[model samples]
Target: MRILLDSFVSFFRNNYMQLAAALAYYGMFALLPFLLLTALLLGKSITSSQEALEGLHRLTYQMVPEFQAVIFNELISLSRLSDTWGWVGIVSCLSCIFPLVVTIRNVFLTVFSAQRKRPVMIEILRDFSTTIFLIVLLIFLVISQIIYDELIIRFFMAISFPLYIVDFMVNLTISTVGMTVFYYAFIPVKVGLKHICVGAVLTSVLWAVINPTLVFLLKLNPKFGIAFGSLKTVFLIFMWVYFSFCVIVFGAEFIAQWDRRKEWGILSTKHGKNGVKETSPPLERDPPSLTP
Candidate 1:
């Protein structure tokens, strides 16, 4: 119990500042994209004249009574915007790269806080490349999803049960892959693909368990309710950004601990004097004179 308490204290002491900075940085980048995406999605409903969109909006309003007006107004505005600006919007989205660099550097430093020096450019480059790859992979996954929706939906409708299972497995597999990619990309530690796979699976399970609870709590926050009324979803968006940072930090620590345990044996036994029983230091018999 003492060890557990110590660990928790250590985590907060070591990570709180970096976590806060990273969250703030990422939150700023996330806000525009998040709002734009929400708008586009809602606009799609209007374009298709889908009653389901209204139902979803209503449900969201009910769940987050405080933010209903804000969310609704944003969605309405986004729907009105011309699609031609999407390319320009995407180009501007690159602004996220700067803060992402800072956040990634901080995450790397946090993971290797025991190291003597800060990460160098080469180290940063490697992490950046891997992150880019992961982003590309995620894009591919999105494209795959689009294809499924466009071409496979009709075929799958005929065998919905089997298709449902396949889709679930595919999503799980992709999520695990994405997590593993991120673990290797961001953490400065060496982890095998197999270990990453294991960590990813564990992360997925944890996320599945925690996500719904988090959503429920976020909806319950009265401040979010107020912000939604004012056409500003900033508070809720910031909360999610911070929540994401916490999850990433927790996942990194979990994977690091797992790797350390495997490599160095149980954490409890990894740091004692080499096979020797611990004892109090011998008392000096006499005070020694200082000599050059």
Candidate 2:
């Protein structure tokens, strides 16, 4: 616990500024259009069916009233806009995907320093792979949510409860996988699957708990709540990004600890052999040689 606390302190003292800037660069670009596109999509579904829209609106209101208002308004406006304009909105939404991915890659490079450990070519290749993986993951998540809304929600209302849990778990799993991939790809040390799984599980659980608690805290504090308004949206996004970095760093420590344990095991085996030699009965020295 002391070590963990020290590490956490070190993260803020060392990497907080960089993390903040990275999030600022990435969050601003990612959040607005992402939310807009999502709103547009939700709006389309809602226009097609009012009951669905109300259900979504209700969910959004519960989570983020202000941002939901913005999204709901945008969705309503987008629905009224011409088909050509709607297509444009869709394209605009899709356009942010690559930039968001690239921003993440840049942030990873800045934070992880994995590039320094591996060959430049290997690092770049790994980075590219990570980017592709994240992009695919994002798409899968969006599609999954859409499918959930369109299909699952229709048949089972109870599904919402499990769906929320699933959402948290899937996101946590992805975050862990992404971090593990980055660690192995860039870091000089090799990490095992067990280590990676440990990191992933820890990160996921941390995120699952931290996310909602942060939201609640933000909602409760007036200074943070209304003064920033949707700007808190930006801060919330930044906080999540920072938390993720913290998790990655924690995972790195876990990997480091694992490696150290292995090294200790090897060293202990050698030490035991040397200790046996020292402890064994000394061979009888021939005193006759000195007398002769």
lDDT of 2: 0.52
| Index of the highest-TM-score prediction | 1
Assess each prediction's global lDDT (C-alpha) against the native. 0.52, 0.52
* Per-residue C-alpha lDDT of model 1 across residues 1-292, encoded as one tens digit per residue: 3322333444465544456456556655644444444435434455354443444354333223445566666655766564654766644544454356446555644543423154678655654565456446544444444455556656777666577666556556656676777777666656767766776786665555455666677667645547367544665655545655565565565555555545554433544645644342111112211110
Candidate 2 local Cα displacement, residue 131, angstroms = 2.0
Error of 1 at 55 (Å): 20
Best by lDDT: 1
- Give the per-residue lDDT digits (tens) of candidate 2, residues 1-292: 5434544454455544454455455555655455445445544454566554555464344334335676566656655553555566666655654455545544444433333466878755665565445444434444545565566655455544556655455456555665555555434545577765765566557655666776677668746735667686556545555555555555554454454455656777787888833232111211211000
TM-score per model over all chains = 0.60, 0.54
Worst 10 residues of 2 by lDDT: 283-292
Instruction: Give the runs in model 2 whose Cα sits over 4 Å from its true position.
Output: 1-24, 30-126, 144-189, 225-233, 271-292
